[model samples]
Target: MPAVTVANPLALPRVPEPNPLTGTERPVVSVTTAPKGFEGEGFPVRRAFAGVDLRALDPFVHMDQMGEVEYAPGEPKGTPWHPHRGFETVTYMIDGEMAHSDSHGGGGLIGGGDTQWMTAGSGILHIETPPEHLVASGGLFHGIQLWVNLPRARKFAVPRYQDITSDRVALLSSADGGALVRVIAGEVGGHAGPGSTYTPITLVHATLAPGATLTLPWRPDFNALVYALGGAGTAGAERRPLRAGQLAVYGPGGALTVAADPKQDSRTTALDVFILGGEPIREPVAMYGPFVMNSRTELAQAFEDYQAGRLGSIPAAHAEVRAATPDAD
Candidate 1:
């Protein structure tokens, strides 16, 4: 509700609109703000667009925007060893540093705009914690963890990891010079994103200059939407003025227009939007705890394996909890 004073606001913290975009409909936007995320005791998360319906986001089941909050010295904290199966996890770092380790003998370190894409195909035990140094010195922490669905076919695919550094991702500016898009998946401005996804999708982190507009196109079949990460602006034809922390769900898929520079009389000056979605994986979803499967039987096996030592555990020798990360390997 109030201005978020983070240590670094993304520096710290797309396109055009025309006719016959081919098999696409201009996106209609509606603003929803009752809730955009759940307040974790520590980190805040959006399990399903907060107040929006689950069908809107389809494949993305959970998305957490970890604290942009400044931590007291020795206060930064994060996830510990846990089991996951039948899905993939994507972590994008905005500020600060973190260490990751998983049961599959993978590990890495990411900080300042790096990304980690992990496929927990069959199952894996992993821990994601701030690097020991950060936890001790204490500093600002800001990051996002997105749970991407694995279709029934690849639910048991072999687990793998992809470490994408900041330079590797495609960062593009709009033709108007008012917006910047940091693409992680799919393509932007004719260039491809770095992260590889089992599900065909596009993920973008866009920042708009005040009043700058980006009208981008997506397959008519994809479910497209935008989340205002910070600041405010208007989306779609309704020109529905959205406040900070609002989710704007679009209809069909076509040219989606977003204006970050609110009109002369508006609240936020800059607009931060995280855009993502793709062809929906129309399948029954069966989930329990961290495991997401198509049926209960698979869910049961996931638990059995963990209890029986099938999913490896974090090594006892390391005092600093971390897993086999993509970058570190």
Candidate 2:
């Protein structure tokens, strides 16, 4: 796709001191494209990061679509009760409200600028419903749902949840006044996010201004990828336009550098992107439907548990949408 010029680039907040690391090893970087998400029947959700399957990215499995969509009044806009195992789902809302409820007694409504971090350890049932504002206004909805895999040791760990408002999360500014970086999982600069994670990873949501440029020091041991929510930019040798919902996975490098396309003079448009990096697990992964495990035997056991009504019920009544019937995509 051709580069889409940004009208206004958002300015970055002031940069803080760099993160202190004991070693000189830098994170590996790569640029990759996100494929369309949610292809199965009934579960008609669109995907952006893990297009074909969750295993493609190994340690980090998937990232769903990001953009604004209008849901008609009284329309059911949400995912019904689904099962997940061996991974965590992180939902960041940019607009609209989502009422989420799960099997672990975790339930709440997350509005614009809100986030939900769910660790579907072992197994759990969960669902999300659009709030009145979304249903009434043909609700404008935009956000990202990312999937992070658990290491072999943590695959069967107990489930957990963390609901955070935008204000509660740590925000980091760029030194060059290029962008505002929201640290969701790992440390950026001297600040770290409140969300507790099992792996040593970093997820940064950045907003950049038209002429701004930002560089992040990284550790080479970790694998990293970037997903653009809006605008266009060049990372190293790759010049790419990041439209809403598209993602770019960067190759292994010790640093990440991003700059707004200088030719695009529109100052009203800003660049919104996600920086995700973590240590890669050199282990086997077996995933079927919603459950992921280290082995097919474990996956089968999960299915058996669900069928035997062992997965347990969601703590509260989740706003229910019709259950999506399964099918081969």
Per-residue lDDT of candidate 1, residues 227-319 (tens digit):
776777788866778655677788985567677754432434578787887778988888777888888898788888877778777676553
> In terms of TM-score, which candidate is strongest?
1
lDDT of each: 0.72, 0.66
**In model 2, which runs have C-alpha deviations exceeding 4 angstroms?**
1-13, 16-46, 50-56, 237-243, 263-268, 314-329
Off by over 4 Å in 1: 1-19, 23-25, 34-41, 44-48, 263-269, 319-329
For candidate 2, give the lDDT: 0.66
Write down the worst ten-residue block by lDDT for model 1.
1-10
lDDT of 2 by residue, 157-230 (tens): 89888888777767667775467777767776557877788877888877777767767766566766777766
For candidate 1, what is the total of clashing residue pairs?
A: 18
Query: What TM-score should be assigned to candidate 2?
Result: 0.82
